[model samples]
Target: MKTINNSSKALLATMLTVLAMAFSTTTQADGHAKPGDFTRGANVWRDNCGRCHNIRDARELRDDQWYSTAFHMRMRGGLTGQETRDVIAFLTSSNKPARKPIITDAKAPTASSKASKLSGKAVYNQTCIACHGADGKGTLPGAPDFSSAKGPLSQTDDILVKHVTDGFQSPGSPMAMPAKGGNTALTDADIRAVVKYLRSFSK
Candidate 1:
């Protein structure tokens, strides 16, 4: 009787341990994309996704595309489920169509005024400064050395804009330049402004 009781207790303990481990694994597998996940996702994106290429705008892809891309990137970037989910949330939100301006009939700034207000430095600071240093010297391993005359900054405005608008992976380099610097909010003019800002580094 004593032996049987001991055996039973040991079995129960083992069973409990196994159950706890199973629960933990399951929890990790199905991560929650709770509120504010996008904010976390942005950090993950900056840390992991930015290493390879320009952090593409989240709006560049569709909902399903974001899901698939996140999955693919999860394996590539070795991202956890929670991180992947957060990135998906951020990307999907960015992809949503822009809402039309409200018809409040209130006075609005003129197009020229709005255009004039768009500063190249502002766009660079907001978007490009994350990977590229303030001096355009580059903060990452493969980032172009804008301060170097032989660097990518030597490229023409059209080429620079194209690279800025679309991702570019240079030969013999492990890192990549992400399209639009991962900020989907930037317009074509914004990209042009950033390109102009980059040119200032070469002069």
Candidate 2:
């Protein structure tokens, strides 16, 4: 009876050990982004999508427009379906501008005041015209013409800002836009002003 009791105790101990190992493995796996992990979506965007497009601010497109653009780019850009979805989820969720409080005070600048005062033409001349041309037509192989009717500027201020800040590398383009036009110092306000300026040139 003593031997049998010892054997049962050993078996129970083994079972507990197995269970513990299984639980540990699961916990570790959860710590990382799985194929479906939206939590890791931002990282994925930074790694993969950020190479070509801005990923931080959402002033570019409305949520619905982002959905379509992401899906189309996923196919043309060779992103896996899961990766595309992850990036889309990140952009749609985190890129929007914050809503301002309603205030009756006369001192508050209207929403338009929040818009940057810098001229798009000045910003372009200072930074972009070398690569994109004075007309906002891209001069280099990888650069895109902002004047193109089909370009992102035709969308909205929100969409343009998001794209500019995130950076984008189209498949055929040899060079990609660096985040914030390769001027890391450019503030979000600067990018918005540039977007507004570029839209003025669009057909």
Candidate 3:
């Protein structure tokens, strides 16, 4: 019984030592930026960083991680040394806890009982064909062809709706697909109809 007690005590001591080392490493990795520095960083980020990348919500990365990421982006985006440091200061200072995005079911408006309903194809031609093309083959560089068998429409309806509404950026591409083709007037139902139309052409 005495030997067993001694083994348990030694094990507890070793665990405490490991925990202390972990805490020390974490503190060194995530040193805090100076206060009031984030505002300057924000301006720098908007001028230099906003052109290529979306301003990520602060909760995405820890203060330390953000510094490292900003340094890398500075090199890639050709930002000046001062500009990079200012942006890092802003990201770290403005860092806050991330809130969960609210996900709600978007309901489509009901068609009038006596009115004729428009077909998805009709909607596509009238509204979408200009950008997406008649064959659902997008001609623009940033646009993806729905009929090409390599586009996002081949995925599920939910994914298509999200992309169409929220938009996306291809890695290394300078341009991004704007939300609802950059038309804020598009309703959730309109986006859903477009998704349906696009999916029909998937090979």
Candidate 4:
């Protein structure tokens, strides 16, 4: 093959640089929306279903049923392809009956638990914002309005933490919220951060 001239090499380098920049921009835009993360899946589930459907029923369906329902709901719910897969993964994993009895008030995780370095705002944005809107008034009917004077925020931190850790249903809400908002990977520290962040909305 003929050797490239200096000008040709410079032009090729410029083109390669442009391509790299475009790729980097695309990756940044994608951010943490990757489909396989249990956390992202939990966020997607809350955004799509928590507003209208009962999130506590994930265990009631088989894997195939979850798959079928996710696909069917994708268009109606406006789920991206990534979100559809993520929620399916969430449902599949969540469906298994726990062999060990669930502890309602498991103490704060020790050094062995999965730890989160995210600050309270970051944690709330990732996990809680989907159901609880940015204003903390709640995005949908069943979610408690954190901004209300007598709402969930009025409770002491310990009660709020326990409710989030163990799952809770408001007295008249349509359904119960799943523990750890269905991420299941949250540590007590993360839950505390989220509770703290949510408290900011009321104050």
Top of the candidates by TM-score: 4
Per-residue lDDT over 1-203 for candidate 4, one digit per residue giving the tens place of the 0 to 100 score = 88999999999999999898777764341443555655567678877785665665666688899887988888778887678878887777656543333444356445324565878788777667766778888775678998875888889999998887777777787766666666566677888888888878777
Which parts of model 2 are misplaced by more than 4 Å?
Answer: 1-117
Better of 1 and 2 by lDDT: 1
lDDT of 4 at 38: 59
Q: Candidate 2 or 3, higher TM-score? A: 2
Among residues 3 or more apart in sequence or in different chains, the pairs in candidate 4 whose N, CA or C atoms overlap within 3 Å are none
For candidate 2, give the lDDT: 0.61
Q: What is the lDDT of residue 68 in candidate 4?
A: 79
Clashing pairs in 3: 38-90
Candidate 3 lDDT over residue span 1-203, tens digit each? 43558889899999999898777753332233333243355556545654676545444578789878987987788865566676776566445422223543344333311232555676566445644667877644455667865666557889877776666665444455544543444556776777777777874
lDDT of 1 by residue, 1-203 (tens): 43558889999999999898877773455435343254456567668987787667555678899888999999999887788887776666545543334643256643422342568998887667756778988766666788887888767889977776666766655655545555556676787887888888888
Report the C-alpha displacement of residue 16, candidate 4, in angstroms.
Answer: 35
TM-score of candidate 2 relative to the true fold: 0.41
- Candidate 4: where are CA atoms >4 Å away? 1-34, 37-56, 62-64, 75-80, 90-116
Q: lDDT of each prediction vs. the true structure? A: 0.70, 0.61, 0.59, 0.73
